[model samples]
Target: MPEFAPIHLLYLALAIVLEIAANVLMKFSAGFTRKLPAMTAIVCALAAFTALSYAIEGIQLSVAYGIWGGVGLIATAILGITLFGERLRPSGWLGLALILGGVVLLKFS
Candidate 1:
């Protein structure tokens, strides 16, 4: 892999954060009935994709996408459970664990 500037990693992290915010906002949007949250979610999702684009300029696309999606999925699921009183079955937890493992493998490979 080519050397990448720290900024690229920062962009990837920012993308993940934005994605999480977008997901939370979308949940609060109540299927887009809530105008403010829905609009904010749209903005956040767009910004997240923009950040991901920037990140891929330096980071490998596979690596960046793996990390972004993996982290976002985990964070969203945790938030859903804690904030929304959502529950995941045993298989769901296993799926998350597998995703985490895949991310780690992708990063190292």
Candidate 2:
């Protein structure tokens, strides 16, 4: 298996973070009922997609997007658990594990 450079991983992680931030901003915009938040959401979405494209330069699109989505889901779940006091049952944990395992496989494949 080929190893990715640190910078490549950094870009990929940044892409994912930006994507998540954009999504969160979009949700906030829904509550504001104003144009400013909506405009900010559009800008953030564009930035996230641009970063994702940059990340694909050094990583396979499939692997990059898979890891991006998988890690994002996991992180969001954790945030929900901590901040929203959401609970995950055994089945949910199993599903999360499967998603993580898929991410590992996609990264190495």
Q: Which structure among the candidates has the greatest TM-score?
A: 1
Clashing pairs in 2: none
lDDT of 1 by residue, 1-108 (tens): 456699999999999999999999999999999999999999999999999999999999999999999999999999999999999999999999999999988888
Error of 1 at 78 (Å): 0.4
For residues 12-78, could you state the per-residue lDDT of candidate 2 as single tens digits? 8887787666656665577757677777877866876787788888888888889988997887777
- Give each model's clash number: 0, 0
Candidate 1 off by > 4 Å = 1-3
Candidate 2 regions exceeding 4 Å error are: 27-41
Residue 80 of model 2: what lDDT? 65
* Candidate 2 lDDT trough over 10 residues, lowest sum: 19-28
What lDDT does the true structure give each of the candidates?
0.97, 0.80
How far out, in Å, is residue 63 in model 2?
Answer: 0.8
The best candidate by lDDT is 1
